[model samples]
Target: MKSSMATPVTVSDITENPHKYQFKQINDMTGQSILNSFDAVFISNSVAFNGGLNVLKDSIYHETINKDMRYNINIIKTAKKNENNKELKKLVKLFHSKEIQEYVGKKFDHKKVEVKKQVSYLK
Candidate 1:
């Protein structure tokens, strides 16, 4: 005669029942706690340029780890558009100037941030 009892195979076998398993989403508090525990984070140049990193304070240090990343500022207008709005033209020109490029590079401590002249709105 055979025994009626069965041996347990593994933890997975004990928890494999769908009715006994549950999944929960991570809340904001838990998410923030995880972020706070990290020593460093990699963020895009645009975020740093916009002063997003200031929130991290001096406890965390950051550098532009990726030099190839680029951000573009585009001015969109109708296809038949002409330079009728002087102020808009001036703003576009100012954005493409070397002065503005130098300012952005210095502001973010990133040498790669510069006006992409080939794809300039003026072109």
Candidate 2:
């Protein structure tokens, strides 16, 4: 005999009727946001570190830390035949006296490009 007051729960019941039990929805939107934010920060930091590292690796830094100006100076130092290249000459002299070796060698030194933050909402 079947009781009219009893509820019949089948496999389909759980999927179709959510009100009969506690329903759980695993939405990854929040997780995706956190992951995206983390990835952005990691990528930005990586780029910044690489930029700073390249500058440090390529330039002669005995005192002050400088970036791409080293290439100009190198060009000036090497271009002895062309006396009329005054534009190049001036840029070399502009950054000639600066030496920034130790700054680049520092452990914590990095050129940060961007930063990211995470937020969440509850409903």
Candidate 3:
């Protein structure tokens, strides 16, 4: 029973049935407001990049809802458009850059694509 409740907690239901902790439904979920009022928050991992982690000093721990589940970010270019658009090339280059790739990978969970090795690494 404990394990079942621990695994998947209906966050919405918590409001309906409160324990010792009092709840405050604030429209603004900024770190400052959260720290001043709320005990905890359920937010995206992306929040770590947007100064959220910095603000939530001690309240930094979080649990992933789905470890195996992953959302892929597909950058699909629009119809034909232009074959040699300098701006477009620059944009693509910026997105592909190591710094940008690293930032995105860390913040947005969009990993940089790696080339396959010629030699098989099978054990």
Candidate 4:
């Protein structure tokens, strides 16, 4: 006759039990600075490509994995209709301008994300 033993469970084993785990959401600055504190850190391409990690010494390694992140320019109909919204309209127009697009392209790595043609909605 042999005695039977039970297997020990881990945090992953209790997937359905919310109380078994502790969760905390840290700001981007803290989270990026402390990569070793967690198993993994996830970030958007804009952050990664724009030298967000340049502040840290060569303690971390990164790779560029292409992701589809669409950038858009939108204006609310109500804002467009209001005559007093000249400033808002001016800002929107600037966003659609070629100069602004070029600036954005330079700001964010153009190789990863491209600025497509601007779309306008006229009444």
Q: Which stretches of candidate 3 lie over 4 Å from their true place?
A: 1-24, 43-52, 55-86, 99-123
* Ranking 2 against 4 by lDDT, winner: 4
What's the TM-score of every candidate structure? 0.33, 0.19, 0.33, 0.37
Please report how far candidate 3 places residue 87 from its true position, in Å.
Answer: 3.8
Of the two candidates 1 and 4, the one with more favorable TM-score, higher being better, is 4
Question: Looking at model 1, how many pairs of residues clash?
Answer: 0
What would the TM-score be for candidate 1 when compared with the true structure?
A: 0.33
Which sequence of candidate numbers ranks them by lDDT, best first? 4, 3, 1, 2
**Clash totals for all candidate models:** 0, 8, 0, 0
Q: What lDDT, from 0 to 1, does candidate 4 have?
A: 0.47
Model 3 lDDT tens row, 1-123:
121324553434464443666555443336444654555655443343354453234346643323222232234254576747888878877877788778856764442242222222211
Cα lDDT of model 2 by residue, 10-122, tens digit:
33445455445443332233432343343222112334344443333433332232332222122223455765687876765554323433343344353311111111111
State, as a TM-score between 0 and 1, how close model 3 is to the true structure: 0.33
Give lDDT tens digits, candidate 4, residues 1-123: 112125432333444654544545555545556667886654434344444544223324444222211122233334446756878778767876889778866654343333333333211
In model 3, where is the ten-residue run with the lowest total lDDT? 114-123
Model 4: what TM-score?
0.37
The Cα error of candidate 3 at residue 90, in Å, is 3.5
Which clashing pairs does model 1 show? none
- Whichever of 3 and 4 has more TM-score, that candidate is 4
Per-residue accuracy of model 1 over 11-104 as CA lDDT, tens digit each: 3344445665443333333433354555443343344435334423432454432322213333344344665778777877787788987886
